[model samples]
Target: MPETPKKLTIATRASRLALWQAEHVRDRLQELYPLCEVGLLTMTTRGDQILDRSLSKVGGKGLFVKELETALLDGRADLAVHSLKDVPVDLHSPFALSVVLERDDPRDAFVSNGYGSMDELPAGAVVGTSSLRREAQIRQRHPGLVVQPLRGNLDTRLGKLDRGDYAAIILAAAGLRRLGLEARIRGYLPVEQSLPAAGQGALGIEVLEARADMHAWLAPLADPATTACALAERAVSRVLGGSCQVPLAAYAQVQGGTLAVDALVAEPDGSVIIRARAAGPVADAAALGERVAQDLLAKGARPILDRLSMPDASA
Candidate 1:
């Protein structure tokens, strides 16, 4: 008789986008292993609850991910599926990013009711965005507009837009597409306009380090291109000591056997922007990213980052 297949339970946030990503993984796993049992352990994270203030104020990247991680640590779930951007570049022991799916559009989307694009919006127009990266980029490009802190999930943010609260808003093009809201996007900001966050538009599967037995089960789901790009982008963040509080952005693209990376660090007020770029063989993606990060730091990124707010939850 054949041995029974192992059951897999994935932990995830209750947000529509998070659910979609988890369900996607579940469906893929089912297809790969027709006899395996897959389940979802959905929970609300602290980031989802504390919506009054900026995510930076409450807790940076971990706020969105801690609970799901806890579920995995406590053995309640076999995996934690997350948006790669939300996962911290510096991970703790016993927890490892075991798999990464192919990336989606790694650009920021401009969504509005009447405006066709953010460039067309008149001066003093209010733009909603939760990310410091988007705010800084918008402020630098369109100083005439008002950048407001917009928090909450996709539906809530869209609700605010529909309610006439913001003239325009910026969001990850990937999320919009994943939710079937791609039609809501009016335009996509070019990479030069808004460098995406590290690991944006990708999915990461987190599993305990001790679960070496499961590696083969998940390895087939990994996308080499996305993994290389994500590593390069995350290397920039790691080398720069960046978190949500700091207005930092990094994007990496892989072509053939080479990887090109772009990174930026800015003051929250959007007064200063330091940017850098690098390209090298894709096999050296992490090294390429670190080189760009060092290039930017040598160009005065550290002082600006020091003056910026550090939102460490433990502190």
Candidate 2:
């Protein structure tokens, strides 16, 4: 008798959005390799357990991805699914991003109780979000509104707004759509008004660098356009050293075979914002990001980067 084929285990966070991403990957893999079995292994990260402090104040985006990477390294899981934005800019040598799924909306969404859009929010209204990028953009546009730190899974955060703990909350539209919660979003923020973080709205498959077989299996799922755009956004963060405390923002989009990127650096209080944009062939996506970053630095991004690297006085 022939031996049984081994099942592929995909590790993911237990959040609804994370599960949706994993399921999407599973379906795609099944279609590609009909004989292979796909299984899901859910694990909680430190970030999920500790919700009292904002992500930047605690540990930044790494909080959401570190544990899953560890699982991959330890051979406990065959692959890990991650939100591309939550991934660190500089990955360790032991692991490689095996596949980048097709991207989603790549824009931020504003969900409020009764407001039609961000502009409709009353003056002094409170908006809840855990991202410095979102908060900074909000403050830049509507200084009169109050932005407060909020932390939780999607449902938990939405519940806070429903219970009147906050008048509105900002979230990634891709996440909401994946989990069938799109109805909660009052409006999607345009990239011109609110630039998204690097690699936002994309999902990544992480695997051991030495696992050539795994890469071969996953390679077919990758989307070159999405990969190009994500790399460009990540380049800016990698050049900046991935400081979680810094008020940094980056967005990359593909248009007419060209990739256009916008990056920003700002004081935490939204006081001194510096923005730069660049456009070039999609093949030069990474270079475009670097060019934008250099422009931002020339416009005074260096001092803000320096201050963010310093030890916190409050600590």
Candidate 3:
């Protein structure tokens, strides 16, 4: 067995949800290595800053982890805990995602003070969300509702809704459940209506690529099923060059010996949505994801992707 770490510091974002994720990891680590002194080192990332613009308009989800990666490179943190959906598909050199813990509810939550579900919202009512994927789906399904940009931490977004900035807002069900705010979720958007982002509801630990010992220490925390699913989902994103710039969603599930993946690409205005699904043996999860991505491209996702990548698409 590898020697247990005597002391470890985890890098984390300072938001309530981010701290909750880090502390959950810390508590689990303590249980495994009772003698280890685990501490959390919280820092704000650019993702947590610049609340005025959407993440897609800025730099994508990499903004969330760049500072934490710097911490690992400089020896300030042994590992960083991240919401897996915030991790980019291609990690830069010298850094690696070491483990994926078990997943929570991988569904989108509908929250509203006046509405019981999205279907109950009146036409022209405002709906706020921080994700383009969710926005596109809403527009496709409910063209009468006004979809608006909502940028901020969980609490901040909720506050906006409470103050009448929106008639309703969409949030990750996992975050609400994790924060013990499950009652706030009036309903859940079915996967058929809104496919989740890759690795949604899961936590990933990032470590330096050379940290063999750290990998050893963290190995026990990984859930084999979740890891396989996350791999497949991320594979789809990687093949499609997915980022916040595009309204893309990939979700995977592992059951018995089979692993199934569902993915989609959409125009920002929700006018176009291309979807694909594939299933295979769990051992071939990544390949199954790639197959689905190719299927989507064949189904006309290529033009949507090409148009979005153009320099003036946002203009």
Distance from true position, residue 288, model 3, in Å? 0.7
Error of 1 at 45 (Å): 0.5
In terms of lDDT, the best-performing candidate is 3
**TM-score-based ranking:** 3, 1, 2
Between candidates 1 and 3, the one scoring higher on lDDT is: 3
The lDDT values for all models are 0.90, 0.86, 0.94
Poorest 10 consecutive residues by lDDT, candidate 3: 306-315
Candidate 1 — which residues are off by over 4 angstroms?
1-4, 309-315
Q: Give the TM-score of candidate 1.
A: 0.96
- Judging by TM-score against the true structure, name the best candidate: 3
Candidate 2 backbone overlaps, count: 0
Give stretches of model 2 more than 4 Å off.
1-5, 313-315
**Tens digit of lDDT per residue, candidate 3, span 1-315?**
578889999999999999999999999999999999999999999999889988888888999999999999999999999999999899977999999999999999999999999999999999999999999999999999999999999999999999999999999999999999999999999999999999999999999989999999999999999999999999999999988889999999987899989999999889989889999999998899899999999999988888886766665
Candidate 3 Cα RMSD (Å)? 0.8
Residue lDDT tens for model 2, 59-94: 777778888888888888899999998888888889
Instruction: Report the alpha-carbon TM-score of model 2 versus the true structure.
Output: 0.96
